[model samples]
Target chain A: MYKKILLATDGSKHSIRSAEHAIYLADSFDSVIELVYVVGGEKSKEDVLHSVDKYEVKREREEKLRPIQEQLENAGLQYNSHLLHGEPGPTIVKFANENAFDLVVVGSRGLNNLQTMILGSVSHKVAKRVSCPVLIVK
Target chain B: MKLQNLKQDWFGNIKGDILSGIVVALALIPEAIAFSIIAGVDPMVGLYASFSIAVIIAFVGGRPGMISGATGAMALLMVTLVADYGLQYLFAATILTGVIQILFGVFKLASVMKFVPRSVMVGFVNALAILIFTSQLQHFEGEGWIMYGLVALTLAIIYILPKFTKAVPSTLVAIIVVTAIAIFGNIGVRTVGDLGELSQQLPVFLIPSIPFNLETLMIIFPYSLALAIVGLLESLLTANIVDDMTDTESNKNKESRGQGIANVVTGFFGGMAGCAMIGQSVINVKSGGRGRLSALVAGTFLMFLIMVLGGVVAQIPMAALAGVMIMVSISTFDWSSLRNLHKLPKTDAAVMLITVITVVATHDLSKGVLAGVLISAIFFAAKISKVKVNEIVALEGKKKVYKVHGQIFFASVNDLLDKFNFNDKVKEVEIDLSNSHLWDDSAIGALDKIEMKFEQNGIKVTYSGLNEESKHLKKRIGGLSKASGH
Candidate 1:
């Protein structure tokens, strides 16, 4: 039985679906979910440049996590949310591996072949690197 | 914990580091030679600087995987120094530049980078690209059609070869193919050898042959200051870029000190001072470099290439180097800046444009950056210098009540005074300053003037909201001219 579930979300539609799967798993097994959101370095750089007020940047990041946190709260599931910095795939992998998560739930990206080859898909990287069972939901 | 961090930073990705290091080393050659020519020194000076700086930085640099080498910005600052006083004086200046950079690191001045607006950063980059592009143009002048044809061929290969295979950097392939064509086809054209002498001899440690006196210090101080500023600016900016690419943070103060050490050693080694190279670092990261080993391999491999293939490298056509440099400039430029200029705030756009124009006009990178920072500061002050005085009409009273808002400083004192109607037939004036903070003596002086004017009109004045600090300041100063009377 999974004791600890790591759920990585970018607040995308695919991630929302993955979060639902995580919620179902946590409900069945009574696993504590560790909800994680990674702020990509590029995005943070853009935030610093665009936001005139520093609080606006913090507000925007929290805004991205509110709905996902609300879903967990409504489910009556025990969970802890974390805000991490770096590229999504590697940071998630590092955190999950360090914390020895029971399983990782991530969303499969919809990028085309060429785009994936160039920019790379974060979920693919996480699946390859993390030392845990990964559930990639579309 | 320390040992683990060292392992992660130094040897975490050995195979990838070595491979990418080779790619970065290959890319470093043309730039090293080109920057040397710009500084009006022998190609060996720049080559040795690149090798020494890279090797030294690998061991001491704050940012792992960031490649440091002879850079165009540093080279441009050295041009007049090398021309006026020759190589010896240039070496002394390089040493001085290193000393200044070390002091900057010790003072933890890297925090000043936060004050630089994003618009200024964009401008600095665009200006650098333009500067590099213009420097390459010198080779194209007075050359025949063969040079143009060779340059075109070089560009084609650099752009097209990666499609077939990326095992080797396209730049290295381009250099090899272009050199082979020029030599085998029996075409006469300018080559790297023509720019300066290249030998298999290694750089040796020696103090520059200059008189140790106050006069010598005076001669090189200006040049050294300029070089120090430009070098640190480029290196720190390049570090930020690499940090973003790798999704990691780097110690900027440590990097500053590392650059100083590298440059100081490079100066003693009969080499020019250098800093982090943006184009080469990008090549390094894109090629999978992720640890300190990559930079180490890059430095060693560059020396190996020069020592083993000195003759062949010397034969590389100037046109090929020109093509490679042109490609670097093009890639270094932020194309989006041009397209989005009209969409940016007018002040921001103007700052960006001015930074680019000043550097292009004066051939001084530091001047352009300084101008940009100054203009942005002015714009910021103008935006915040408004002291709003709004009448509180909702409050039922026969006396006038005005709420003061925004900053009260020298720039806004006139606005603060202008909002009050001095000739109004009011019995009392109540000024509320709870929301506003007084910044300086000028604000207190202005308040005193307003109170005196109201008193002359027989209107009693009352202050409703003087914060503790402002009240202390006002009491200590005792209303400017009224201090003596008190």
Candidate 2:
């Protein structure tokens, strides 16, 4: 039933699992997967400090998405990827809502209640804010 | 198109802007007062400058959500001028600072920010934190146990209350609670009123009471120039930080112009010049500020607080304000820099340390940054000033062929010259530059000297494999022998 699927990945194992779920749904529904990766403020600042060359920072960021891109290409699926900057949860929510994605998929580590209360899980924020149905893979 | 962007900038996130604006306003008070004390001016001067700058910058600034106000860096620059010539001359100097900054924007000097290395930025921020911390120490002099107790209580509320909720800024909570304790409990401590007189009256426009002549310009020009440079540097850097934090781009040239405008207006209002405050901007962003309205609200709310609750603010103990500033200084510092000292390159570490020490010692932020930049440039030049010569014998050791590698610029020309032997026993000397590039007139001069020396030694010198650009430069200088294309 979905024509456009939004998948947010950060190259973690949980996100890899979430990518599989997205691929299966896209295969069945003939959907176009809109892949997104966000660079947070702290992470971006650290990258700038660690890498003296601008191109090195760009290459490092692109390397994070290589595995997912390889997987998407192996499936022979139609997709477009975007690199965005901001807080991960809010950036993804804003993009998905603004672009009117049919569904949103994210991965969660399923932290304990106390930890989530203090640290604020990104998937929790994304699921709550996005207008479309969310698939939170653990 | 313009209207839509303006609407988005001002009204994109109303609830977030209003709430964060109030938070920023609450944080601005102690900072304004402290910076005033540093500059040897009354507390109201800094307050009025903060109010005007924030409100004006909200409208004209290129970066929304960035907070601009009276800052310690700018105040530190004003100390000598205020001490020597009084407040009127300081006001005139502020106006001139604005004009100079506007000219800088017109000339598009913001492009120079790229030359500032990341290490220097880290050092600047750490130095600022140190300065703020040192400024707080003056409040603890000859104080009783009650002052220490109140400060500790303020710190406790600031650090602990945020764990349960962040709906209200913990800094605001700490200030309110501590103020209540100091007033109701009859605790004896130094209040803000004890620092200087604070009137609830609005700032009125007044020309600086000074002669408008060349003598006046001579008096204020140097101070104004220093203030302008420091103010623009701090503001532009803060703009970059905000741009990164919010994942947005800002027009830095426009920000320069906006800062100039704000300072000019603030001067007429009998206030000192100021710039963007990194601590306040970070607080605004973390509190969900995302639009121009946040800064506008911060300015207006500060004025509102002064007018409506001036009496209560006056009764606030200096201990509470010092505690808040200490917290700000702690957060402003880059603690990880210390941890990463071993991981960073030795040159970068040295540059950062030098920048920090220079700033802390001289109380001059711009000079520290400049020193860091100059040192890093020298280090870079030294690193790249290598010109290697590879010698080969093609004619049974009778003819020596030298292959040059690496860039030949002013720094490397001497190294290049030193690599060649004028008394070589060969009949012919061939210098091959296929792998090297000539960058400046110095490289050409070195080539000429090498050829002259070889000729004088009864050896014929010929250059081969000159790239088109270098060949063109050689032809222009007419200094070197012919280069046969290889």
Per-residue lDDT for B33-123 in model 2, tens only? 8789888898899999999999999999989999999998888778878999999999999899999888888899977766888898888
User: For residue B219, what is the lDDT in candidate 2?
Assistant: 93
How many clashing residue pairs, candidate 1?
Answer: 0
Error of 1 at B308 (Å): 0.5
Model 1 residue runs over 4 Å out of place are A1-138, B1-4, B393-397, B483-486
How close is chain A of candidate 1 to the true chain A, as a TM-score? Answer: 0.95
lDDT of residue B134 for candidate 2? 90
lDDT of 2 at B293: 99
Candidate 2 Cα deviation (angstroms), residue B354: 0.9
